[model samples]
Structures are given as C-alpha cells and as structure tokens.
Target chain A: MTPALELSSIEGGYEPGLPILRGASLAVAPGEIVALLGPNGAGKSTLVKAAAGLVPIWSGQVFLNGRDITRTPAHRMVQEGLGFVPQTENIFANLSVLENLQLAAALVPKDRRGELSKMFALFPDLERLRKLPAGRLSGGQRQMLAVARALVASPSVLMLDEPSAGLSPKLIGVVFERLQAVREAGVTILLVEQNVKAALAIADRAAVLVEGRERLVGAAADLAQDPRLAGLYLGAGLEAA
Target chain B: MLQLLADGLVVGSVIALGAVGLTLTYSILRFANFGQGEFLTWGAYLAVTALGFVVAVTGGGVMQPIGPFSFGWELLVAMVIAAALTAGLALLVDWLLFQRLRARGAAITLVIASFGAALALRNLLQFLYGTLPEYYTREIQIAIRLVPRDVLGGLRITPDQLLVIGMTGAVVLGLHLLLTRTTLGRAMRATAMNPALARVAGVDVAAVIRATWIIGAALAAVAGVFAGLVGQIRPGLGFELLLPLFAAAILGGIGSVWGAVLGGFIVGLAESFSVPIFGAEYRAATAFLVLIAILLLRPNGLFGEKP
Candidate 1:
C-alpha cells in the first residue's frame, strides 16, 4: 500500500548551503502513527518541516499519497491535504477559539466547513472554551486547540512538531491518548517527539535520526526493546552495535 | 465653551477620517505610510476636476445651491467620483511602488519608499493644479445660530460644519459594522495580528492588502473634500495636515479604530482650547505636545494592547 507521506533521501535545512537533513528517508503508511525520535540538533524537526513544505528541501522529493508535492508553498500545503502544527505559536492567540476554527474552515470548500463540528466533537474541551481567546487557554488546552485546528482542515496527513513539549506529565498522557485516537480515525500522523517511551506506546512505528541521518527504522515494539537506542540517540558508538 | 466645542467637532471630523485610514494601514502594512496624506489631496483635486468637467458639459447651467450647502448636486456627484478615483490611485501607488518594497522585507526601505512616493504624488498634484488655494464653492453661507447671541455666548454652527460631523459619524458607524460584522473584516484583523497564521489558514493576504488601500484612500478622500469645503485646498493642503493626522493615529494607540476617532477628537479639542492660551499660531504645536505626553505616559496609546 502507498504511504500517506514519504520523504525520500531529502536534503534540506534553513540556509541554502547548510543542510540539516542529509539523505533522510522516512515513509508513513495510511492510518499509521510514526514517531520521529532524536536528540537536540538531530534534524528531526527539519525533516517534518520539509515534508510540510515549511523547510526548503534542496535535493529530494516529498510525496503525499503518491503525488510529488516537493515545490508546494507552505500556505498551499493545507489545501493539498497536509496539515502541520508547529511547536510554538501554533494557534492564533488573538482570535477566539471559535474564530480560530472558523478561520481554518474558511480555507476549505463551503460544503466542507461543517467539519468544525467534528473537530469540536473530537475536542469537547475546546467547545467549552469556544468563546475565549486561544491565548488565554492553558498550555495543554492550547495544544489541543492547535491540533483541532489542523484536524478541521481534514488533512490526510497531519505533521505535529513537539506537541508534548511544555506540557505537564498528566497533560502529556492526555495528548498521547488523543494522538492514538487521531491515528485510529484513519489520519496518518508524523509526530516529532522527545519522549521516546510515551511515543512508542502510541506510535505504530518509530525512526531515530542522528546528525541528519536516519540511524534506525523499525516497528515501535522492536525499537523499544533494542538496547542500542541509547547509544544511537546519545552518539555513543552505535556503529559498533 | 459651546462655540469652541462646535468648532472642535468640525476639525475633529476631518482628523478622524484621516486617522482611521492611517491607523488601519499602519497596523496591516506594518509601516507608516507618509503618502497617506496625499490621498486626501488627490481626492480633493479629483473632485474639483470632476466638478470642472460637469460645469463644462452643461455650460455651467442647472447649478443651484441645496439649502445651506454652498454648492449644488454637481459637487455631491463630484465627491463620489473623487473618492473612487482616489481609491484607484491608492491601489496604483501600492502596485507601482510599495508592493515591491514590501517583498524585500525591509521596514526602513518601505518607509523611505513611501516618503519618495509622497514627494512624487504631491509634486504631481502641484504640477496639475497650481500652488494657490482653491475652494469647492465661491459662495460663503452664513452660520446658523443654534443659540442666539444673548444665549450661550452666541453659539452657532455652519451647515458645512454640521455636514462634516454628520458624515464623520456615518463613516465611523459604517466602519464599526465592517470591522465587527463581516468575514473580510475578521480576516483583516487576523492578518494584522499574525499574517503567517492567517495566510496558512487560507486568507488571500494580497486581497486583504488591496482592500486596506481602498478603504484607507476612500475615507481620506472624504476628509479631503471636507477640508476643501471648510477651508481651502492647495498643493500643500494634505502636507500641513499630515503631522496632525499622525499625532491622532499615535494618540489612538496606533492600531485601534475607535482609538483613532477618540484621539482625533482629543487632538481637535486641544488645538481649539490652546488658542486662548498660546494664540492661533501655536495650534499645531498643541497637537504635538499632546502626542508627546501620551507617548511618555502610555506608550501604547489608550486602546493599544500591552505590546
């Protein structure tokens, strides 16, 4: 079966000559949850951004459902069935919760704007605070609002960058549970996470990267038992293993 | 005191019209457009040109005063034409000059480019119409006394002053509706707050920018026409008012629409009241004084959020 999102040997970074992602390859099948794990400066976020067209891929192809979308602008990617939630400032802080949903819905066809109710159903907490500004919400609530906003676009592939960051441990559990529910709903998810154990619990597959190269890719359960994960993540001579 | 208020309202109306445009553009464009004042001059000139054409077409016949108004229906028609023409010119200026500079993402360059645009537009007006001041109508209507000379120290207001105030109120109300009730307005506010998020959400950022220019120039045109009706229109007409317009925009919190209106009234009253203490020659100075004080005390202006 064709994957929902595929990044093939992607070479990209912030600057033209400085490449943070070098020959990074990852594929997420439809209805699958893939957690991208790596330490700081491991280019995990860069790979996700490149897939979402936020980072410029100097040399590679990004495919969404077998169609190459390598050159699509970041703003147009949503209409093409790709939704991305950045780690920070993902929600429109100044707008009310309803306005945030309405703004995203406006991009979709008029007939499909009714999906907002589905989003509200998925995140009933957002419905309770619909009138309040997104800025006033708690950290976890804001993250939920951001995810709901992306989901309202009805993207076939949702890419989240560090969704669990800045959340309390209890809230982190809620976020992971929500991610599981989202994957169960048949939306392919590419999650960039630092919490390896929690991510593995929900992720169908996991990929580890170090210094812009993919070090390991396997089923979540297989990677969870591998003794080399610490060495691979911390750069402690994984080549010997 | 009543007469001063009456006079202040007339001046306040003009400033408010210009300030609304100025504030909106500043918030959305993220630049102080020096060329905004020229929209007023262009509007007034466009109206006068249209009036001249109308007079020539009918051999100056069928022209008659409408009640207390100095000019007839032809001037009203001309005002509409002027507003439309000025709006078009504003769009043209943005297309020809500002848009390219904006793409470079240099705030100072955009501001300097606006200054350059202002010079070109102001000079173009001067070349087309001479430097001498011109009025919409040569006829001077006497002020209507609301209170007799014996009552309230001879309080009175002219028809033109009343019309200016009425138009300002209508425009302000219309703007309030546009900003609060419409989807386009919500998009505009969203764009102003976070352009990146707005764009990703599928707002046509370019369309919003174009709409902003149209609204800004349209309101400024009305202010220009009123300026001519109340006093006189000259090449330097908008230039002289530009400083006061900026003062009002800053005093109103730089981005808030209602703040701009309130700031305009405050500035107008300050100017009018200063006449008794510092003479009419220092009227403009009072506007700046109030602006400086507001900046020092409340850097964000009254309606501005803590940014």
Candidate 2:
C-alpha cells in the first residue's frame, strides 16, 4: 500500500551551501505513528521542517498521499493535507486558547469547522482554559494545544517536532497517550522526538537518523530491544556495531 | 486647564488613530514604517480630492452643513472613499516595495525602503496638490463654553472637536470588536505573535500581511481627514505628526492597540499642558521627554511583553 507521507532522498538547509538534511528519507503508512529518532544535530527536525516546507529544500521530493508537494509554501501545506508542529514557539502565545483553535479552524471550509468542537472534546483541559492566553498554559497543556491546533485542519498527515521536550515524565506519558488516541482517529503521524523510549512506546515504527540520513529503520518493538539503537545514538560507527 | 484637557483629547484622537496603524504595521511587518505618516498625508489629500469629486457630481447641495458640524454628508462619503483608496495605495506600495524587501528577510532593509517610500510619497503629494494648504470647509464656528471661568479654569469645546472625539471612540470600539471577535483579527494576532506557527496552523500569512496594510492604511486615512478637519491639509501634515505617532506606539507597547490609544492621550495631554511651561513651539519636544522618561522606567513599554 502507498504510504500516507513520503520523503525521498531529501537534501536541504537554511543556507544554500550548508545542508542540514542530506539525502534523508522516510515513509509513514496511513494511521501509523512513526517516530523519527536521532541525537543532537542529526537533522531530524530539519528533515521534518523541510517536508513541511518551512526549511528550503535544495533538491528533494515530498509526497502527501502520492501527490508531490515539495514546492508548496509552508502556509498552504495544511490545505494540501499536511500539518507540522515545531518544538518551540509552536503555539501563538499571545492568543487565547479558544482564539488559537478558532483561528486554525477558520482555515478549513465551513463544514469542516465542526472539528473544533471535536478538538475541545478530545482535550477537555483546553476547553476549561479556553479563555486563557496560551502563554499561561503549563508545559503539557501547551503541547496539547499545539497538537490540537494542527489537528484542527483535519490534515491526513501530522508532523510534530519534540512534543515531549520540556514536559515531565508523567506529562510525556499523558501526551504520548493522546498521540496514540490521535492515531486511532485515522491520522498518520511523523513525530520527531528526543525522548526515544516514550516515542517508541507509542510508535509502531521508528527511524533513527544519523548525519542527515536515516541509518536505521525497524519495528518499534524490535528497535527498542536492539543494542545498535544506543550505538547509533552514541555516534558509534555501523562497523563498530 | 479644562480647555487644555479638551484640546488634548481632540489632538489625541487623531494621534491614536494614526498610531494604531503604525503599531499594527510594526508588530506584523516587523519594521518601523516611516511611510506610515505618508498614509496619513495621502489619506487627507485623497479625501480632499474625493470630496471635490463628490461635490462636482452631487451638486453644491451635498456641501451644505449637516446640523452643528462644519462638513456635510459629502465629506463623510469622501472619507469612506479616501479610506478605500488609501488602503489600495498601501497595498500597492507593499506590492511594489515592501514585498520585495521582505523576500530578502531583513527588517532594516524594509525600514530603509519605507523611508525612501515616504520621501517619494510626500514629494509626489507636493507635486500633485501643490504647496498650498487645503480645507474641507471654509465655515467657522464659535467654541461653546461648557463651564464658567471660576469652575476649574473653565471648559470650552467646538462641535467639530466633539465630533472628532465621538467618532474616534466609535472607530476604536469597532476595532476592538474586530480584534476580539473576528477570525481575521485572531489570525492577525496569531501572525503577530508567532508567524511560523500561524502558517503551520493553515493561515495564509501573505493574506494576513495584505490585511494588515489595508486596515492600517484605512485608519491612517481617517486620521488624516480628521486632522484636516481640525487644522488644514498640507504635504507636511503626516510628517509633522509622525514623531508623536511613533512615541504613542512605543509607549503603548508597540503591538497593543488600547495601549497606543492611551499613550496618544498621555502624549497629547503632555503637549497641551506643556504649552504653559515650555510654550506652544516646544509641544513636540514635551512628547519626546515623556517618551524618554517612560522608556527609562519601563524599557519594554507599558503593554509590551517583557523580553
């Protein structure tokens, strides 16, 4: 079956000559959660951002449900059925929680706007704090709001960069549990995460990126047991492993 | 003191309107657009041209005074047309200049371009309208005394001044509703706070930028027309108010709308009260002194988020 989201031999960066994502590639199946795992400067976030159209792609092809969207503008990606959530500044801090969700919901056609109510149902805490500014939300609550904002457009694919970054272990578990529930709702997820154990617990498959490329791809259950996973994260050569 | 307070409010209304646009542009576009003053100048001059057209088309009856106000229904119609035209002008300038500079992703370049655009726009207005000041109406009215001379230094105001104050309140209320209730307003606020996130959330950021120019320019146009009603329209009208506009925006915490309005009033009152100590010629200087003093105490501005 065709994957829901696909990145093929992507190469790109902020500057022309300085590439952050070099020949990186991944494919996420429909309704599956795929964690993109890597160490610092591994280009994990860069790969996702490039696919989302935030970072310029020097040469690559990004396919959403088999349609090429490599050249699409970042703002139009949601309309094209792709959503991205950055690790930092992911929420509009100055806007109230309801305004944030309403703003995102407005981008969809009128009939699809009802998804906003469904979001409030999915994240009841957000509904309770609907009138509060997003900046005042706790770390975990902010992550929920960010994910909800992306989900408001009802995109076929959702990519989040490190939703568990600043949260406590319990909050990370809570957030990952929500991600699992989101997957059951029929959305494909490409999650870039540093919290490997938490990500693997929810992800069906995980891709370990090293030096701007995916160096390992396996089922989450198998990858969690593989000693090479730690070696990859530790910058150990494949020969050493 | 009462008369000064009344006069200060009248002046503050115009400054508040103009500063709203300046602050919005600064917040969203991430630049101090010196060309904003030209929008005010252009708005005023555009109203003059539009009013002349309206009078020519509707006959002199349209120019007849409406109740206590000096201007007729024609001037109101002209103000609307001028606002639309000013919005279009702002969009055109953005398309021709700012948009290109924006692609370069340098705030300073956009600022420098705005200065050049301002100079070009002001000189173009001078060339088109000539150096002579223009007026919306020639009829004059006497100030009505609201209080006796013994009662707190007396109070006096003209019908036009009251209209300015009332209209400013209505416009500001409308803007407040737009910001708080409308989807576009939320999008604008979202874009202002976090542009990248706004885009990922499916907002068309380019459309938001266009809307910013339209709303900002439209407000500036109304302010220009009001200024002309209170004083006279000239090439330097907007340029003269530019400093105070910036001061007001900065004082209110560059991105806060209500802050801009309050800052405008404070600056206006300072200028008005300073007429006694510093003299009328130093009115502008007094505004800067207030700005400096306030900045020294609160560097981020009154409403601005602490960095």
lDDT top scorer:
2
lDDT of 2 by residue, A175-195 (tens): 999988888889899999999
Chain B TM-score (each prediction, in order) = 0.96, 0.98
Task: Give the Å shift of residue A95 in candidate 2.
Answer: 0.6
**lDDT (0 to 1) per candidate:** 0.87, 0.92
Residue pairs in clash, model 1: none
Give DockQ for candidates 1 onward, in order: 0.48, 0.85
Provide the DockQ value for model 1. Answer: 0.48
Per-model i-RMS: 1.9, 0.9
Candidate that scores best on TM-score? 2
Q: For candidate 2, lDDT tens digit of each residue in B1-307?
A: 8989998999999999999999999989999999999999999999999999999899754589899889889999999999999999999999999998898869999999999999999999999999999999999978888999999899988899999999999999999999889988998999899888888887888999999999999999999999999999989999999999988888989999998998888888888889988899999898799889889998778898887
Residues B1-307 of candidate 1: C-alpha lDDT, one tens digit per residue: 7888888888888888999999999989999999889999999989999888876676454457788888887888888989999999999999999998897768888888889999999999999998888878888789898987776676788898899899899999999888766767877888888876666565778888999999999999999998898889988888887888988999989989999999988888888888888999999898889999999999999998898
lDDT of 1 by residue, A195-225 (tens): 8988888899999988898889999999999
